[model samples]
Target: MNEPLAERVRPKTLEDYISQHHLVGSKGSLTHQIKKGIIPSLILWGPPGTGKTTLANIIAEESKRPFYVLSAINSGVKDIREVIDKAKQSGGLFTSKNPILFIDEIHRFSKSQQDSLLGAVEKGWVTLIGATTENPSFEVIPALLSRCQVYILNAFDKSDLEALLKRAISKDKWLQSKKIVLKETEALLRLSGGDGRKLLNIFELVINSEASDAVIITDQLVLDKVQKNTVLYDKTGEQHYDIVSAFIKSIRGSDPNAAVYWLARMIEGGEDVKFIARRMLIAASEDIGLANPTALVIANSTFQSVSTIGYPEARIILSQCAIYLATSPKSNASYMAIGKAQQKVKETGDLSVPLPLRNALTKLMKDLGYGKDYQYAHDFTNNFVASEYLPEELSGTSFYVPGNNQRENALKTFLKNRWKEKYDF
Candidate 1:
């Protein structure tokens, strides 16, 4: 085929599809839906090249439903209407099996554009399958979002990527013609950055560049070939993650200059304003929690502002948030505390709740000692009672370790005074 290898190898069936087992596996949520032809409107949210388009195609095929496609990047309301018209004509509306309308990058649709889809979706003219690399909650309109089930497609793990390569080699007639050996795959996997499509593209590019039919792929060979054709800013691939990593790290490391520099790179490269702002929101909580809770407020405001005012103006809001987060006091106490607590839960599964901690809603529960010995904190002196809240087995376990910052130090003092050495605050 003259088409790119990625397109040529596009999966035609769910068995041919890779990754996302949680959705397509034997016990997956969508498994029954696809098998029974009871497909509903859904929003597939994930990073780039996670096979959102492929999965949509598979759903339509497996469910024996007519499929119509639209690219949100280029399609307008007129285009959406055209597809809906065709879909309604091909199959009756509100029937048990409605035609599927697959829209790629649905996040790019304008408010009016999205609004136009409401009636058709609500009236069951089309089973809308919207794919987005951005968060649907932020990009999709509330009215439309509420009508669709959101399914997340995670980045391809190492094994999934490896299987993709093996499948390409074993299944593709063109690749089978050549004697190809995967000697090393670090460069290929690292460069693709969990994007199955990008990985195939890089693999094909490397194989095609070779003068001989016999190809032995190695890390060095892949790296050298990719470097020649790679762009400095790959918004959807490794560079995307790498640059964002540097941006977040710079802020976490408290280097405002570096943080702003990376932020500028992302903005200049046409990175979505909300994506940048969202990372800052995470950094505010993960890196600057407790030390400066206000950072989250500012980050949230920046996200809201940029979502309303996009492009050139949004860049400034993002930069302002980046610098503020970088300058704020840093702490991961809250982040670590939850992590530790979660680990404890996993270690000690389903510990019984102490009787005093359980609610005494009924007379039977009260007779069973639920809340029988519970002391009301409001009824005690200083509205403080030295009571154990955790499972009795973990009476004095400490999950929170206060960070060495002024705000957290005060928190530590308060905790210490209340617990009186019960926990090593």
Candidate 2:
């Protein structure tokens, strides 16, 4: 009863686990491996409360291996070494029964800490099962990442959350003593933001606050009971995502005032400085694009500056870049171009490259007429030549259209003069 309801109701076996069917289902990616006890080192990457930690526990339990746990938030190289030494002594190094070391929030580990894991994972001394709420490609070191397979754990859907509530109601003695009826779940589901653990926490809070023995769960009751002040700012929860989204949208909408307000909210909430900078880096190219190519340069510089000078000083750099990006001419032309091009590739499959465009580096390639009749732009007038670069099937196709802005209008003019009516520019 002292423990949190989530821990008490935590899935004990793979059968009891909920959601992530792609990983734990009969034909899931990890199904056969767990069954055979030939588990590989892997990083479970997903959103918070999606059972990444739970999956790691289940894998170790089902495989019947010695399970060791550490948190990246507090553990360091010394802690890692101690755990590895223990695993080797108890489970035997380079054996089939090597221990499983689960590190929660593995993304929080610094490069040196992650480096410490390399030896243990590579030597088969331990099978590292890391749980991260962030992208492993960005947070994990390359050496460690290469040694482990990354499995994605998706967010819990409506049914998954509902099932969790139902299971908790039936399994927990405390909840069973009261006649609790789930009359409505929208508030719980919405408030949890697709997080199964959060859903249970909110459910337990509502149930415990009730004065009567009988409790009927309704949207209004749930919403009213849950603290409305929670929206102030949460760096790891729904508010974290919401605030960042608002910040990005404000920049794209060309409102510096609103953008700075959201940026300040994130800064006050102690958001990772690099995370904020990275999002701006993306927005620079995605929102500003060719309309103002300089925005990307400024955003990139901001990322590097903040990364070096963190927090108190970084806030100044972030504000400067955010305002510059907001005031810049906005355009999603570059973003749309890649999306349209990718769609075309998917639709066309692998179309053959025209012989003229093919590289004729080898003698055999030249014999096959590679690079034949390929127009050299410098050989023609104005250092430009008209030619069909796309596959013959997609002749004259245009994926990029210049945005309606001062810079891009000049591009439109240049392209118009060169292609004439070919691209209908």
Candidate 3:
């Protein structure tokens, strides 16, 4: 029988699951816990096709616990109650072996629906395993989240996707029977966009269409087939990542033309406009920091305006911000500086605060020379004093490096004049 490709290739165990090594790897905390037969209610947070549902099944199977599956989209409070009742009938409250209730797209469940599961989860009638593409902090209620451990599942890397493809070709009964030769995989990976299911579906489509015994797949053939199928922009799928990547890269490259093109692609694809706006706000600070100080302010205001006035009109606001950021003078000096400083902090363990800079709220602190030798900048010339603020271990450590932009250049000049010996321009 020809079952759906995703169903046919679904992983049955943690060992068979591709990617998510951080969760299932030898040293993984979750793996260790599951191996010890200590299962905790967990919320698997990740993008689609990262094996959230598959992992949930593996956890249930490996734990040797009864598994009950529910979809938030179709299941209601009544359905939840039935499952809870069944779980309670099968296992007592104090028993260690409770049924694992797997809820797919848990974020789609209304508050009342989620509330229904609370009692079962708390009473140990069911060990809830919820999967969400959205951030659980925003979607899942605090009470529910507190009871469940949240584990982040990252997108599959190139190697992980390759491994999945190889497995499908060699292991799948139907694919093994066919004579399939992989000439190139660029289009396959590009079309799948890190989705294992989509990759296999595309592979099925190409292989099924081939008439020759020794079928060869090429980039051009894959593109032609996919394009013929309309290649619709799935807001939750490939187009989402692709468009966002293009949009951010355009801003980073300072190409207004490319930025607008990508922005239009996202808009046409019906992307969440606010998501695009939020990315712009981040780019302003991370990419255009110090170079154009006003960029962040503008991006933030644009986000607010777009949120208030959504869609058809919101596109205009997004375009304005996108173009402005693309054309603005760019510098990542502030971003790089913070990164370097953080690395240094990690390398050299936390140093004690300098005595002069320490708070002198109590008598003991005052006696210990806290704030005693500190030179008040307000009492000095130009409201600036050449005083050591860093600990003795890091007396003159420099962190902020001004960029080549006009504003930073002016800042550099003023700092050089204020502290001739310490501030090097």
Candidate 4:
């Protein structure tokens, strides 16, 4: 009765695992590899309760490999070394179905801790499987991430959640004895926020609250029980993402009141202060841009301040920066410029740099026309020259169209004045 229903009903085999059919179905990539008795070092990236840990365990079980578990929240470099030593002792050959090293919340591990596993993972001492809720590109070291296959797990859809519920009711001996009838599931699903573990825990709580053996579950019953038992927000799960998104959007939308409200919600939920500050810094650039250049400076300062000060005092600094950003004139010109430029680069595929723009450090390069006939802006009037700076193939291509804000309008005027007919501004 004390064990969480999520753990008690945890799927031990692939057949019992719900959702992620793309990875575990008959023709799935993972399934194909498993059949051949080879599993690559992998990173399972997805939201909480999306079966990342369970999937990792299943891989180890199905492959008949020794499995090791570590939580980045608690494990350090020494712990990682100890695990790697144990893994090395158990034979370090890939053919013997190398041991699976599964690190839950691998993103939380510091760089040094992550670095400790590099040798083991590279040498086939262990097949590393890392689980992260955050994007691996941002959280994982490039060297480590490059060696692992990244598999994305989606949140359980409505049908999947319903299947999990039905499975629990039919399979669990205690739940079956309770004779629970699910009259409605809207409240249950909504409250769970697509977290299967949270959903099951809520269900179990509802079940325990009922005095009658023939228990009937309804929307109201679930809402009442959960509201009474659960915290307002689970900062580590879906609510964390949802709240942060709302906070960012509020600032982007220029709604100070809404931004502050979400900020307070995050503060109350005990969210990492630096996380909030980092998002604000991004918002300053992506959402505020050149319209308020000072916003970025302030946001960066806020990040530094919060990181140093921390907690109760940091909340004030965070609030001040949030309000300033929300009230500032917003623009995305710089952000859009880079995105458009990248798109053009992708389409063009490494077009040769214009010879005039190329640096000719060697005499051969100079003789071959690199840096030949190059116009030095300082040699001309107004420290400007109207020469083709872009690659020859993209000479007339324009990626940065100035935004409509006053600051960008001034910039447009400046470019038009200097380049004359070259700039279409």
Clashes of each: 0, 0, 0, 0
Model 4 deviation from native, Cα RMSD in Å: 2.5
Q: What's the residue-level lDDT of 146 in candidate 4? A: 91
- Candidate 2 RMSD to the real structure: 1.9
lDDT of 2: 0.92
- Give the deviation of candidate 1 from the true structure as CA RMSD: 4.3
State how far residue 106 of model 2 sits from its true place (Å). Answer: 0.9
TM-score of each: 0.80, 0.94, 0.83, 0.91
- Tens digit of lDDT per residue, candidate 2, span 157-221? 88999999999999998988999989999989988988888888899999889999899999999
Backbone clash total for model 1 is: 0
Q: Which residue pairs come into collision in candidate 4?
A: none
Local distance difference test, each candidate: 0.92, 0.92, 0.87, 0.90
Model 3: per-residue lDDT, tens digit, 1-425? 47867778888977788888888898787988887767888999998888999999888889888899999989999999998888888773754678899999998888889888888888788999999988898689998999999999998878998888888888788888888778899999987878877888888888877786677888988887777864457777777887789899999999999999999888888887777888999999999999998999999999889978989999999999999999999989889889988988898889888888888999998998988988888998789988887778776677888888888899889988876767456
Quote the lDDT for 159 in model 3: 92
- lDDT comparing candidate 4 with the true structure: 0.90
Error of 2 at 385 (Å): 1.6
Task: Write one digit per residue (lDDT tens) for candidate 1, span 1-425.
Answer: 57888888889988889999899988888988888889889999998888999999999999888888999989999999888888889874656688999999999999999999999899999999999988898899999999999999999989999999999998899999999999999889988889999999999999999999999999999988889787768888777889999999999999999999999889878888878989999999999999999999999999899989999888888888999999999999999999999999999999999999999899999999999788899998789899989998999999999999999999999989899989999
Model 2: how far residue 27 lies from native, Å: 2.8
